[model samples]
Target: MSTDHQESVQELDVRDVDGEPFEQIMNALDSVGESEALRLVNSFEPVPLYDVLSKKGYQYDTEQVADEEWHVTIRPE
Candidate 1:
């Protein structure tokens, strides 16, 4: 799906979640628009998030930017 719609991809930098990444990410997901995607920045591979979001009808693509940094782009299926 094209993200050129009215709502652009919403980005959330959760590298500093401090043990509350799930809550932070869930909140961010709440604001995602139908045509928009959620781009998450983290310090590690958020393996659990993939499963959580998958169950919510979202799919993701991940890329490692550094040894300890990753970028995950999530969109509705």
Candidate 2:
């Protein structure tokens, strides 16, 4: 419905993060428990990141913001 509602009840913003592998980010989120994990990435290559994170048991959603930047939301399983 609303962005905030969608983010709170359905998602969480991981915030802008850079210079980290998708696997590493997933691993870190895993340790945090089965909550929503968001990753703000500064990479144009979001497909691979999405694939990798999604494969790790996260319901992944991605949005491109600006140049070489994206916001990825992962709901952990």
Candidate 3:
């Protein structure tokens, strides 16, 4: 996506999740507006979240930033 598109997405960084991260992610997703997206940053690829979000009518793109880091952009389809 273009930098401008990315800039408008609602961002969520979960690399610092104290315990469970799923809840935090779900909350963010819930707050995403129809015209907005949720950008998730994590220390590792959040595989399970892909399925969960997909079932909720969200499409996602994952980019590996480092060996153990990933950036996932989720948007309503």
Candidate 4:
């Protein structure tokens, strides 16, 4: 038998949290125990930023939001 407890995407709004600065968001992640929740960033940059975050061991998923914007969901590894 299969269970039906669908885990919906928990969207932690970045505008309300990060504002714009990535550093401040990282700090917030640290304070809140990164593993406890996920973070979503609304930005378009693909390579450089994702590269840095990957190197830091943050597992993330991305989706296109607009013409040049994307929404990234970040979670702890």
Candidate 5:
């Protein structure tokens, strides 16, 4: 199956993002509503980000949609 399906939640695609996408992700997360989820699309699993978000008391679920595409849904715990 293709990994490019449309997202049903708030999303940010960083595949083409220049520089580090960490700040961009943080910015996107800041705007997430209480009942919403932030989906981060990237070229690979963002393992480092998992630690950062986890320490901040957030929860997430990651799926490797394709060999090069990963989607991480992050939300407040």
Candidate 6:
């Protein structure tokens, strides 16, 4: 997969979820396709997750749309 911009993606919003959403996020990423992406919506930027994703051959871009809103688009590299 070229990892080009993909329209087909899975969006997982964890803003109102209870407890930690790490496992939930991981599971979501696990099901993501090679040519697709995982859009994570959260209350804060998941900076620590960058390393984990990078190690898994994935790259991500984080954008803070609001004081407590962040969006990370994860794509396979």
Model 3 is weakest, by summed lDDT over 10 consecutive residues, at 1-10
Residue range 1-77, candidate 4, lDDT tens digits: 35366333445455554345667657755654433545555555445567767887777778887875667776666
**TM-scores of the models, in the order given:** 0.85, 0.55, 0.85, 0.57, 0.86, 0.88
Candidate 4 vs candidate 5: the TM-score winner is 5
Better structure of 1 and 2 per TM-score: 1
The candidate with the higher lDDT, 1 or 4, is: 1
Please write out the lDDT profile of model 1 over residues 1-77, one tens digit for every residue: 54454657888999876776898888888888777889999998989888899899998999999998899999777
Q: What does the lDDT come to for candidate 6? A: 0.90
Count of clashes in candidate 5: 0
Rank order (by lDDT, best first): 6, 5, 3, 1, 4, 2
Model 3 over residues 1-77: C-alpha lDDT tens digits?
A: 45545335889998888987999999999999887889999999889888888788999999998998899999889
Quote model 6's TM-score. 0.88
Candidate number with the higher lDDT (1 or 6)? 6
List model 6 lDDT by residue over 1-77, tens digit each. Answer: 35456468799999998989999999999898887899999999888888999888998989999999999999888
Error of 1 at 64 (Å): 0.5
Give the Cα lDDT of each candidate: 0.86, 0.56, 0.88, 0.61, 0.88, 0.90
Model 6: CA > 4 A from native: 1-6
**Global lDDT for candidate 4?**
0.61
Candidate 3 error regions (>4 Å)? 1-7
Q: Which candidate is the best by TM-score?
A: 6
